[model samples]
Target: MKSNDKLAIHELLNKAAYGYDSRNVDMLVDCFAEGAVMSMSITDGDLIGPFEGQNEIMKLMTGAMEGQMDTRLHNISNIFFEKEADEAATVLSSLTLTAVENGSIRLLTTGIYRDEVVKVGGSWKISKRHLDLELPF
Candidate 1:
């Protein structure tokens, strides 16, 4: 891989992690494409749905994170990127999330993110992302 490609991948991953941790809905939306998909498992059930556009993605994230007095730290590891073309790639990464709530910091979740990314306007954006989480039952 060329140095520039490595840099692009790193930037993309960092942006994603930062966006989520900061709870910046707009930033998160910018990381994905129009009609992008994001799904994850929750205690209630699987929150599986497609976010058709950036506006919808913003609404989903804002509503989901609302009223949670929690600050999250995203530790992204084992990122493997497969080049699908000059403008696209498939990436897989493991994530460990730590959160602080009620003055206690703890490991909140662990998950894997399978993502399809495309370069849009010279920046990598996620076209699809599936999050599979592991929880103790």
Candidate 2:
């Protein structure tokens, strides 16, 4: 893959993580394509969703921003590009989540994400993302 392509993908990942942690729905939504699908499964909180399209994703994110939790932060690292092409790429990233639940601060989750990102409108956007949790909150 080209250097710029790699860097662009990294930037996309960074923006997604930072935006989610910051609770900026617009920023977070901008990282996805119109028909994107994000399926989330977490052992804690009994949450499993196969959110389809940007609207559904935004709805899910809005809940996260307004949830009863005191605070939540999502950090991404150890990104690896499994496949890269002019139109699409498959990437895997390690995830670390910290949050305050029931008024006590705690490590929420540790996991990885399998993402399908595509170049749409000349920018990289997530077409699909599936998060796998290693531990619960």
lDDT score at residue 49, model 2, on the 0-100 scale? 75
Which runs in model 2 stand beyond 4 Å of their true positions? Answer: 43-47, 100-105
- Best candidate (score: TM-score): 2
Candidate 2 pairs with clashing backbones: none
**Could you give candidate 2's per-residue lDDT for residues 1-137 as a string of tens digits?**
77788789889988998888878788899999999998867653455778999999888878767764567777889999998888899999998888866778778779889999999988999999988887754
Top candidate, metric lDDT: 2
**Candidate 2 minimal-lDDT segment of 10 residues:** 40-49
For all predicted structures, in order, the TM-scores are: 0.84, 0.86
Location of the lowest summed lDDT over 10 successive residues in candidate 1: 42-51
> All models: lDDT?
0.76, 0.85
- Candidate 1 lDDT over residue span 1-137, tens digit each: 45686567767777878897899767777787877777666544667676666676677777867856788788888888765677778888898888888899999878888888887887778888777778621
